[model samples]
Target: MAIAPQWEAALQAVQSPPAQRRPGRPRATGHPTDRYEAKRKAILDAAARLFTLRGYEATSVRDISREAGISQATLYHYTGSKPEILAAIHNLMADELLPRMNGILQSDLSPERKLAEYMRAEMELIERHPTYTAAMRHKRWLLPGAAQEMREKRDEADRILDAILQEGIDKGVFHPFNVKFARLAIMGMSNYIGTWFSPVGPSTIPEIADGFARILLQGLLSASPHR
Candidate 1:
């Protein structure tokens, strides 16, 4: 089966991971004491770089195994395939990111303020781990189980945003729009940052977050201040 050209980049990128951090139930709150987690992270980082530089199909498990200083058997023990590695990378990101978002959602800040915080956190995470961003763009055609799992988690994030937007609309603080579409547009804009935005660039992550929030708050249509 052939993937579309536009989707190919992302499919290969998914061989890396998403730009966002993953969230989940916390097991041990502290960092790993052993070298296992550290080695795993190093492998993932190296794989991300390799996948980005060379197409996924062109990059082999032997390449990652060699780059990570681990044996092919060890790499297989950690992750079965490229897609599985991508899924694991995303799971790691979500585990780091979602808990923070959940905390923000629980805070006393106004809906608008919460949204701004979420955007900032999101952009910062993307800046740190951009491979995840590329993977997300080509998520649809990924290995079925892992891809669906990722989609469900992503939907959870959207639900959080949707709730915030709904709250603002109820309080007459936000412009009314189709909730699903608005959420998609907002998230789509944020998720694509890996393709163009760079953490080392002149424009800082905070600036990008601020700009996105500003656009979300102020639509292109002129508004009446009198209202």
Candidate 2:
């Protein structure tokens, strides 16, 4: 997957060295904590890129270390194991979606509007973080605990969507449908976008999101015969 412009800028920024210290006193390398955070972010960026290009199961610690341009020891100092890194990436994807989804759910908007906003947010997320979405699709099976945590977060997101759908049904704004299946259909559609969406494609994220929301709320069948 092509790296987004912002990610490209971030990778370059982290690779650049700190400013030279003044000659008079002692050389400074900035704060140790800042250096550690930069290195950690770099590792995650590399891991997400590699995991997107190569299957997560096939990527090794050595691969990540090399991609990050750090020694194996240095990589280990930041992230202990490959699975741990994968877990972090999974959490990162979840963190990006959860807060926005929760806010939409908690808002005073009507159910249909809430669902539309949620769909837009989700589509935008997939557009911005395709690599993370791809990595999540090919999850590592070895980490059961980590997998369970991710599943729980996913379920919570689904519940919020389901609640909105149910509210729509109750209010007669939407057809009565199985909320669980509706939620699954919406999520499955959004998830599949990672496989084909292009940053430089003709359609923008909002365009895609609007099309999806329209399809979800209105069936594709023509309402009348052609004139």
Best by TM-score: 2
Worst 10 residues of 2 by lDDT: 218-227
> How far off is residue 147 in model 1, in Å?
1.5
Backbone-clash count (model 1): 13
Reference-based lDDT, each prediction: 0.68, 0.74
RMSD of 1: 8.5
| Cα lDDT tens digits for candidate 2, 1-227 | 34444344433443443333344644559998997777787788788778766677778999888887777897888977988888888887788899999999889887767877898888888766666666676675538999899889988898888888877776677766777888888888887776667666789777887788888778521333121
The runs of at least 3 residues in candidate 2 whose Cα sits more than 4 Å from the true structure, single-residue gaps closed, are 1-35, 220-227
Instruction: Count the clashes in each prediction.
Output: 13, 0
Quote each prediction's TM-score: 0.77, 0.80
Q: Write one digit per residue (lDDT tens) for candidate 1, span 4-122.
A: 34434544544543233236643665456555676577677766656655646666888878766667787887676777777777777777788888887888887677778788878
How well does candidate 1 match the true structure in TM-score terms?
Answer: 0.77
TM-score of 2: 0.80
- RMSD of candidate 2 to true structure, Å: 5.9
Listed per candidate, the RMSD to the true structure in angstroms reads: 8.5, 5.9
